[model samples]
Target: MSEAVISLSNAFIYQKENLILSDVNFSINKGEFVYLIGKTGSGKSSLLKTLYADLWLEKGHGKVAGFELENIKYKEIPFLRRKIGIIFQDFQLLPDRNVLQNLRFFMEAMGWDDKMKIDDRIMEVLELVGLPDVLKKHPHQLSGGEQQRIAIARALLNHPEILLADEPTGNLDPEKSIEILKLFFKINEVSDTAVLMATHELGLIERFPRRTLYCDGGIINDLTGNS
Candidate 1:
C-alpha cells in the first residue's frame, strides 16, 4: 500500500450554526481511487471543500498532501492548492478563453514565468486528457465530455498529488460519464495520482469497485470489503 496522502481525525465542519460534518474521519492513500458517496445535503461537498481548504475546518485535525489544513495560514492556500487538484461538477472554464489560454491563466497565476515551458506543459496535459487538438477550441464549442476533459487536463497541469473531483460526471451522459471515469482511471494507473471523487452515481461506483466512503448521518463509513 502507498502512503497516506490525506488524513482526517475527528474532523468537524460547520456552516454558520449548522454542523454539516461531525466526527468524520478517513485516510486516503497515495494513488488510491476512492469514491465519496452520499445523497445531496449530506456533507459530501462540504467534506471536499474542507479538504481543498475552500472552507475552513471548525474542529479536529486534517492534512492534505502533507499540508496541515486546520488553521492553515491564508497565504499558504495557493501553495496547498498547487499540490491538490480540484474538479467541480460545473466546468469552471473561462467563457472568453480558449482551452490553451484558460490553462495558461492558471500556470501564470501559479507564478510560472517561462512561456515555452508553460506552453509545453499545457500541450502535454491536454494530450493526457485526450484533447490535444482542442487547445484552440473554446469551451462553448466543445461537447460536455470534451469540456470536462479540459477541466481534468487543467487540474493535471500542476501535477497535483491528489485530485478531488466533486461530481465530475454529473452533467455528462452515461457514455460520456464512462469515458471520463476511464480517463480518471488512466490517470491513476499512469501517474499514480490519488483520486477522491464525490458522486451520487451508484452504477459507476459498483462498476469501478474502488474503496467506498459513504457519508450518512454526519459520519463517514468505509464500506469496502477490506475494512
Candidate 2:
C-alpha cells in the first residue's frame, strides 16, 4: 500500500465562523504530485491552510506528515510544519535579508542549530532550484522567478515529505511560471517529495497534466489521472 502523506476523511473546512467546504475526503500518497484547481473564493486556500494547521480543522479526521490535525496542539504545530514544506503565492522572502540569511533564519526557527549543516542544506536546495549563486541577493535584488526559486529552496530546507504550495506561480509571467513548474517537477522526481500545488492556471494544467484535485461549490473533487 502507498503511504499517505496527507489524508482527510469527512473533513469540514472553515474560515473563522464561515463554513467553506464540507465532507472533504482525500489522501495524497507519498512521492505523488497533485495540482489543486479552483476558481477564486472556492475554498482552495482554506483547505490548504487547514492542512498546514494555519486554520484549525474543526470537524473530521485529518492527518499530515504523521500529525493528527483534529487533535494537534499549539505546541506541536511547529514540529508538524517541519515535516511539511509550505510555499506561498507571493514570494514572501524578507526584503532586508539576503537569500542565505533568509533560509538560515527559517532553519533556525525549525530548530536547526548546526551552522555548517544549515549552510550545506541551503546550498543543496538552491542547487535543486537552479539558483545556487543567489545567496547574497536580497528579495529586491532578484527577479520574480529568482525570488520564487528562493522560496522553493527555503521550503525544501527540512527535507519535507510533502510540499503544500498555494499558488506558487501566481505572480510570475507565463514563461517564468512554466520554468517554476518544471523545477517543481524536477524536485518531485529527484527528492520524491509529494507536492500539493494550488493553482488556477488551466493552461498550465493542460500543458503538464497530472492527478488533480478540484475545489468548487464548497467541495473537493478528485480529477485523478496518470502523471
Tens digit per residue, CA lDDT, model 1, 75-184: 99999999998999998999999988999999998788899999999989988888899878899999999999999998998999999999999999999999999999
Q: Quick one: RMSD of model 2?
A: 1.4
Candidate 2: where is the Cα deviation over 4 Å? 225-227
Please give, for residues 48-157, the per-residue lDDT of candidate 2 as tens digits: 99998999999999999999999999999999999989999898898899999999999999999999999999999998999889889889989999999999999999
Candidate 1: global Cα-lDDT?
Answer: 0.91
Quote the positional error of residue 20 for candidate 2 in Å: 0.3
Clashes in model 1: which pairs?
none
**lDDT score, residue 172, model 2?**
96
Task: List TM-scores for all candidates, in order.
Answer: 0.97, 0.98
Best by TM-score: 2
